[model samples]
Target: MRGARRVPRRRVIQRLVAGMTVGVLTTAIVFAAMGWFPFSALRPREVQVAETARIAALPTTIGFHDPDSYFMNDADVNQTFDKMLATGVKNVRLMMPWAGAEPVQNQFDWTNIDRTVNAAAARNMAVVGIINASPQWAVAPGVPAISGRPASPAQYADFCAKVAARYKGKVSAYEVWNEPNGAQFFAPQPDAPGYTELLKAAYPKIKAADPNTTVIGGVVGSVTDWGTWLVNPVSFVQQMYDSGAKNFMDALSFHPYHYTLKFSDGMAVANSPLDQTVALRRIMIANGDASKKIWATEYGEPMTATDEAGQAAYIADLLTKWQEMPYTGPIMIHTTRDRQTGSTDPENVFGVYRTDWTAKPAQVVMKDAIAAGIPKSPEFQRFSAITDPSYGEVLTPVYRATPTVWAQARTVSTLFETPTGIIASPTAVADKARQFGGIPKTPFQNGYQDFDLPSGMRIWWSPATGAHAVGGGFVQAWVPQLGMALTDEVRDGWSTKVTFEHGYITWMPWVGFQVTMT
Candidate 1:
């Protein structure tokens, strides 16, 4: 399976050094006197989307919204991930139940997240980390439900920063909150302004942590049935832009799951995507956000257990329809495996595979589609098995997880400096450390840090010369293969520098910094 290549230590240092320059990755960032960054200081840079491509990447790394991602143990995580890879799907949309990860204020348990992310990385899969729900402690004081909005949007935003810092490279995309249009996820009521406030707060923080990580907004639930709990998503999303939602998102996420609608229905649902989603796009186009992509965040049809052929038909139909749409990116099915042990649960029927991890016709369809490069197929308007009451049943799912490690307390003080500065977390620096050959012998001091590469050659950071990390362009492509920094950050006028065995890398303001060979 093709996975992300691990850059050699020499190459890692080389790239950072090569790419390390002001205005490349981001405007050279500066820390406040007390190392505190106000939200204003963290305003998210506009997202940079890749060119629209055929099939959204070869073999189409279709996204799958894995169910109960938070509850899985390590073994089950691996099992589930392997199954997904087998289906030719390499991108996953996972729920990061915020309350579970952060039961206590300012404290986080990364055990499950670590497993989930590392598992995906090991398989060369990219993950979309969806931060969801309000932590009980952070819920609005007057609101009684745990699902209520946070007491302060900043609190949520800060939490988002911490998550992004921790999983910068491993998780490439983030959705601020899920399905705010659906009252169930947002609770109390779906408040567009409230969700907008959250986006406003979190957007800059996540972007500040890693500008390359895709930040998606308008995580709207598909509008089908309407009640006090639901509003027209199309109308609601337009309200988001009215609330100035465009400033924060790089892409828009749409969950067009009209559970009762036929798969062949496409985005043509009467009150749903055909109307609302289309309107949402027009809002983007009107607002000059045409370059932003639209993601089918979650779309799946429920059927009786015996409706294998029906499920297969839906998959075929969705792939063809989705491929034909230019702006639509990542058709993430609602699931990978059945979620229940019995047919009594409607959710169980959404998986491409049966509960036992055995291939259903849907699974076969998925495999064949991947192999055949998703050729056009007939769409399904109806599945007969769904109408039949005799076919519903479920088997015990395979691969139960027995987690060996659970999350424990970890703090920001545990973090280390990265090419960016002291702000990048230790975990985010893990790969850099690996690629740099070894950890720095000297502790990071002042504003600079160093690494010990092989061959007596070293690399360092300075206010005069940026580290080797370039933003998304040329600097990334240019660098000396390997070296290490032997010294900590040392102040130099208004900037700083780190001394490597080879030379000094400096960082200042607009002029940036430069490297001088010893």
Candidate 2:
């Protein structure tokens, strides 16, 4: 009691208060600084999709969402996916409404969701499960229990954890919410902070439940709407990054709906769906989320396209352009069938099929695109856009693969892309590289990747050379011997000549001049 007298309570309290104050100030400063660039660019130019304007030949069985899957009977659900499979759809996106999944606090109901996921799994299709919209019991008194922000982030996280734990391996990915940037989707007002909070909460819960399940942030809508009624798409996303959103999402999602006749336009337009993707990706790159891919989760031209045939054409065009995007994976075309054809709401007409599940002209084009292994116009010429894979090895320069093979493995994140995108089947590349009697390396580096196969060969891809083998016998014998990967591609009268390497390989009308070697 003499030497170690009781500490002064006032001094102890003062120290604690000072520390807390400093911590709060430091956090405030960081958050403020993060918003500097964003606040400055409140109204910026719509990002243009220049080099990224090329289209790809996506597999026919792309992923589609069922707007009413939760309410649909088992028979209807089965028929929907079955019809999808028959038409080449390999994946589906289903919703696990927080309200329905756990109606009474802890009384979780996994029955409907379980059936949806298991049904897809049985069809060998993947499912992208989503969790959002708070329940009435969980939210504040008389809050209307909308499909927007929850009672709190914790409640949303708890719900997500339950969904993740229950579905674990069945669901391929989990999107935080639908369209948080839209007032209609997020409710009250589009609060970017609240959405970020939701992601911050839900991402970890889903990951903790199953690390393999991909966690995507809330899907975003059009970025070029002039930032009037709702949050600016780019700004909303920028705020998300500033608020430490990158740490929370495995991938970014966007819905690039073209409002008017711009549906058939090229990606160069500011409002082009492809342009929207390119712009969003630019934001990702600037915000240090370039490692993450952008999925055009929902995009389509509604049946407002005058005639039913016009709607079909719009679907084909939109799908074609999006499939070409290098930054995208599993590009979904909204829905398989129109949800509200009988209602006055035009939004219900985005489906490729009628409400009765009958195929529209667009649906027919889709099926044909899948069957032909490329996007082909049923009425127009059958264009061989992506290379004919049947030719053992389709040797073409990057320029030759333009419009179809613009981006490949290096810009890739999904297995689907790794197989059919730029490199055009890593399997075939690996097998061929092995035949060359050389140990191959993983496709690494930036943007497009280079593969170092045995026998002094390097898989180099530039805008000029496209993607080709340089310096080795693997490219030497093309026709007679076979199994060779030659940049035998030529465009604009400049077919790839297997001349002894001296400099950059180039062609006109596609990839411009860039660095190369001899």
Candidate 3:
């Protein structure tokens, strides 16, 4: 019995040993296959600053046929000036009637102009005086009354020189003529020959008077295909460039009035103001004059007694759009107050203010838009602060304002900042974080995390729990509202709990949290 029990114990021991060895080998193989014993390497780190680009200028101006006549008295002028200054406007555009200045040959009456200039200067606003109108002495005695029409290029040059010399530094910029391509004043010309000649002669005179002053070409009217050849703004501009008129002016100016239609309709026409600008830019680029900027000297949609809200919306849209386009410079709405003349069309009511100088709804809307920041999409954002309360009253011959919100957002989208090795502020860090998540939020509520985990380790985040549940991450952990897909890892979270707060939970998906395992 003892011999039989000993033999059985040896076989059992051999079998147990073999079973233990196989189990250990299988566990080792499984660990090796899963690569669980090896360390994972962290990805390369890239940091970027999310700042908006400097957008195009928003210079607002007032179009005044005659400031003295329109305002009536010195008190009225002063009142208007005060209002304009309140709007954060820096420029005004006034048409210096050639006839009014030189009613008699060589006799210049600078009384009204001097008063206007002094008033504007006191308010710290620059003037862009457009020398227009034809004096009876300069034109054929029988020629119908219009803006100045000098008989010859030499005559025009002389008048321009005189005006430029008188104003000198007081006037920041000068325009040679108004609408030369139109039959209104620059009548009877082959293309823009008459206008080009006038520019060539006046350009030197203007420079001679005041080298510091900028000279802009007169604002052309229509550029539509249906427009007459003489009034075809595009043709006139092309011809002017062909004739070496580009070297004369600091900026090319034009009137982009979209008539009575809504802002969207005006934007839609084939050869509308915006489209014409694209064509102008191409021409400027083609002519190697890319440095020259285009100015919309006169632009606005007419408001009516019945449709004030529509007018307000149109103005808001126009300003917002202007803020977004990088090439658009200054935009001067046609008139600050509705005029008695010019047109009897009830739709000719383009006044931002009523006749009594009180602001219209459109005026309030503009102030609000500028104050809140011009929205990029009319559907998304609000206006900025009212930097100027009397923006409706004062004529800014050369007004320059800041870009709207829409412009700012677009700028941020394309913005890239080179590292300067400077420590970033809390606000700056928050901004960057928001940008990374494709969600915009105020800097105060930005969420962040810090970690000190070991190197050569990767961190991942998910709404799920347990091992191997990493890849099936939910965008709910990322973008809670817009339902965006997670395609990229935004940042590395250190040994800190990142808690996002408020509307930020779903509102700003641009920030999130994750932890690393060593």
Candidate 4:
């Protein structure tokens, strides 16, 4: 409804380019030579440099949705931009409300948006604009009178074209609409085909107006219809593709508000934003659109219910995971300042700063991440292969992977504790190290060492035994009935044995593991 503030749905609680100076190009080449780069310099010079910088510039991994920046007083606006810059924010996401700018069919006022865009430009910060809110005149007759959808797709296209034309050089990208999958934002009841029509109409027009501007589509919210308020985001994205939305936009965007769910929960739980994003990627891959990136345009926790420290930790965790995903792009936090300092409403407290402009723990975390250049590294977590049917393959980031021996320390203490540090393994044993996890830890005793796996399994190695995985239900049964293994696995013709602190477990070729408690 037009009556509501453009706050995000109540439920769920949930890149720069240009100015590639010669010096930066030189730096890019130098980094490439040292094996640190967006691309290898194995290609032609012109194409290599441009593509490299463009890749590096992408995903704009650390931006904030500073809607308040559009309405701030001149002094506050300048101050806010300064704060954002000091924290290393590479870009700012602004709300370009269509209704406010185009109230009466083409009669336009760009005062607020102009101020915000100009402020960001003055500081050399890129701007990603959210073009939303349909004016009353644009709503088609008999439409459900929802707040942000226009009557005809062309009406929205016209506005997008106008915006792209007006701020061609200043704005870097535009999101078609915000959360159109939610009845709260779209009209005629959250129809994917309907939203795709808008994207199909607007993409070409916006490109024609400003060819360099990126048009991001599929701005769906992370929600499912509990009743009639929302459409399942994963299914909605597929519907968009079915409606031929694949070629209409440069990239797809979604709001990944976790609400009460933690980032870890998203990794393991079924319908989390992270899980949904994976499903959406699968959909894209199946449609042969695998190269397209999925941007998390809005993500954050409201401090009213989630503690400040908790918000910082979750955001940090989310950023690390985002960096690990090759298909992901920028992850923009919801807002810049609390809408009201002490309001109980979650929307009012999503900001990393209080309304009075004091910093929160989340702001500090953002500052540190930006300063670190948002490095890409594995999260020392249980990894899942995108193609694995049962989660066995170990996936390491191309760069900054944890050292094999040290990485095994996550589950096994002996590896990090033993003085027999970094013993060499035989070629046969080393070849299958990844199957266990990383390199083997030092031999815990005279002739035996262990390799820990991400799946909580361990591989025991000895001159006599060579190497073999010893885990699964057998290990589960062994740990309770017996204690930690006291000796490496010993094999005789047809059986295997491992002595534990209080007992022993014997394995027969056909009979599996049998434990004997002392």
TM-score of each: 0.60, 0.60, 0.58, 0.65
Whole-model lDDT per candidate: 0.57, 0.56, 0.49, 0.65
Candidates, ranked, lDDT: 4, 1, 2, 3
Q: Is candidate 1 or 4 superior in lDDT?
A: 4
Cα lDDT of model 4 by residue, 296-354, tens digit: 88888887666888988878877776655667788788767787877888767888887
lDDT of 3 by residue, 267-348 (tens): 2234556546555666776777777777776665554323667767767666766554445567666556655323445433
Q: Which ten residues in a row have the lowest lDDT in candidate 2?
A: 5-14
**Top candidate by TM-score:** 4
Model 4 TM-score is 0.65
Give the winner by lDDT: 2 or 3: 2
- Put down candidate 1 lDDT per residue, 1-518, tens digits, no spaces: 00211111110001112222223112122111111122233332222222211224222447678845546778888888899889887788776656545544554555556667777777777788888656556775545323556768998898899788777766778898887776666757788888899999999999999777888888886664356577667777778888999889988988755444443342222453433555576678778887787787777656652366776776666666555444566778867887763575556567777789887777777777767777633211112112222222111011001121111001111122223332221322322343433444345454333443443322334435434322212122224532444454567798767555566667677856666667
Top candidate when judged by lDDT against the true structure: 4
What TM-score, to 2 decimals, does candidate 1 have? Answer: 0.60
The lowest-lDDT stretch of 10 consecutive residues in candidate 1 is: 393-402
Candidate 2: tens digits of C-alpha lDDT, residues 430-493: 3233334323334533312234434456554434434455544423332222222235334546
Per-model clash counts, in order, read 33, 8, 34, 1
